[model samples]
Target: MKLLALVALTMCAFAANSVLNRIGVALQGMDPLDFATIRTGAGAAMLWALVGLRTAPRPVILSPKRIAGAAALATYMIGFSWAYLTLDAGLGALILFGVLQIVVFGWAVFEKGAIPLLRWCGAGVALIGLCVLLWPTGQASIPLGGATAMTVAGIAWAAYTLLGRSEADPLGATASNFLLCLPLVGAVMLWSGAGPMPFAGVLTACVAGAITSGLGYAMWYRALPSLPTTVAGIAQLSVPVIAVAAGVALLGEPLTARLIIAGGLVLGGIAISLAARR
Candidate 1:
């Protein structure tokens, strides 16, 4: 029960980061790139601070591989923020997660793991649900730029997860990845002309980065060894649902019937997919 609760909490933290980004960028008028840069920079600093305080010897080593892995982290941070600037939180999450699942499943297959038929079926159902969730209604034109950015973010995160699978110490690896990526993030933000950030934006970005992204991701790594690839995929499906609720409750975003129905299908399909793994 405790493990399950922890997993749920971890997912909620992940979901809340999205909500925070949406609130800051969409509602608060903070530049998305600025948010990403500050969030990652603060997160990297906080993680290293904790590492310094802890006397444990580092369990992960940096190499060329680690540098490559850091690129994915950079992509996720930058792409996600850029995407959310024009996309709804729920829609952005749906796209990001849909790609993530497909990538992970493909990686599992390449590793010679058994691919269950039920899991594929679940994927199909979930895909359909995602289509419905993303399908624009009544002349609501999709933001092509935002959609592309979100897709890139999804692919980046998928790569990040797969990279973690190979690391002996995922938490240390993640921290190191963030540390390495921060400078790159800053450069991009500066190149994009992101100016001085507002105090409110800074606070929100730091909280999202340090607490939700940093610690939440570290905790996710702690739980990963106990979870199968399929289960991990399914567990992540909850993030979009949680974000939807947060959007409605905190951001005053309207909850439409379509979102409710589509979300149900998406989450239900993910549950079925994961359950079939056993």
Candidate 2:
């Protein structure tokens, strides 16, 4: 019961990040670059604080693996923020989740040198769903740039997840990655010359970072050891759905028939792909 509750809360946190980002950038007039920068900074601070509470202070070691993790984190943060500028929160989450599944599945196939038939079929269905979602329509069309950015974010997040698979201490590693990404985030902000950020936007970004992202990640890591791999994969399918629902209820985003059809395909394909492995 506790595990179920934890998983549910973690999923909500993940979904909340998408909603918060959309509100911050799309509704609150926050610059994407600035939002990303503040989010990373705030997440780093929160994670480091948690680390301090959990462990004795020690000198940090810089490793290649950590650097790679940091780079992936930076990519995901920047791309996610930029994508939300134009993409509807629900749609962006769907794209990110769908692309993430494909990337991870693709990498698994590459590593194994053989693909399962069911996996291939699942991937094909997911691809078809993506096409349907991105297809031009008279009523409303997805922005190419926003979809592309979200795709990049999804790929980067997949890489980051893969990199963390073997970590001895998930929280410590994550905190280190967030801290290491701070410099890169700052560099991007400097190059872009992000505009002034409203206080509401800043607060939203901070909540996304410290609460939804930082603490959520920590809770997920804690729960991961108790979860079956398939269960973990299946549970994540809810994040997009939750995000879409939240967007409609909280942000007053439209619920279109096209999204319903495409989302079903994308999510169903992902579920089939993961379930086939069991």
Candidate 3:
């Protein structure tokens, strides 16, 4: 029950990030690059502080895992922010989680010999759901640039998740990844010359980084040990649903039939994939 609660909290936190990002960038006119920069910086600071309190300070070891994790983290942050500029919060969340499922499932099949037939069918169903969601409809259409960026973000996040699976010290590793990614994020900020940021947007980013992302991710890592891989994948399916509900209530985003159908299929398919017995 405790683990379930923790997992629920983590899922809420993850969903909250989508809400905050959409509010900050889309509603508040905050520059996506600036929001990304602040988010990464604040997350690093918060994680480092937590790590310091947990144990005596020590030099960070620059291992290959840390480096790759940092790069993937940076990619996810940048792409996520940029994509939100044009994508609706709910739609973006769906694409992000859908692609994430595919990446993780694909990795499993590659690393292991073969996936169970049930999972394959589930994957096929999920792919069909994605097609239905993305099919060009006269009523509304997703922006190409936004969809592409979110897809990349999903892939990067999957890589980050895979790399962190075996981590013994979740907090320390997460802190180190955030810290290492700073330089890369900074260079992009400089190169892009991000415009002025609103104070409200900055505050929103801070909360997202420190509370939702930093603490939320730490909790997730702690819970990971107790969860099976299939269970973990299925659990994240809740995030998009939560985000969509929040987006509608808070951001006044439209709740369309297409979104409803696609979401049902996507989440249902992923659930089927993970729940099926070998």
lDDT on C-alpha atoms for all candidate structures:
0.81, 0.78, 0.81
lDDT by residue for model 1 (68-187), tens? 777998999999999987897767888888888887888788888876788877877777777777655687877999999989998898887766655566567768988888888989
**TM-score of every prediction relative to native:** 0.90, 0.82, 0.86
- Pairs clashing within candidate 1: none
Q: Write the per-residue lDDT of candidate 2 for residues 148-178, one digit (tens) a residue.
A: 9999999898787667566667778778888
Q: Clashes in candidate 2: how many?
A: 0
Q: Which stretches of candidate 2 lie over 4 Å from their true place?
A: 1-5, 56-61, 113-139, 222-234, 253-278
Clashing pairs in 3: none
**Per-residue alpha-carbon lDDT of candidate 3 for residues 167-248, written as tens digits (9 for 90 to 100):** 7888888888889987888789889998878888999999988889888888887787776554566567678776776777
The reply for model 3, stretches above 4 Å from the true place, is: 56-59, 113-136, 253-278
The true-versus-predicted C-alpha distance at residue 120 of model 1, in Å, is 2.1
Worst 10 residues of 3 by lDDT: 128-137
**Candidate order (lDDT):** 3, 1, 2
lDDT of 1: 0.81
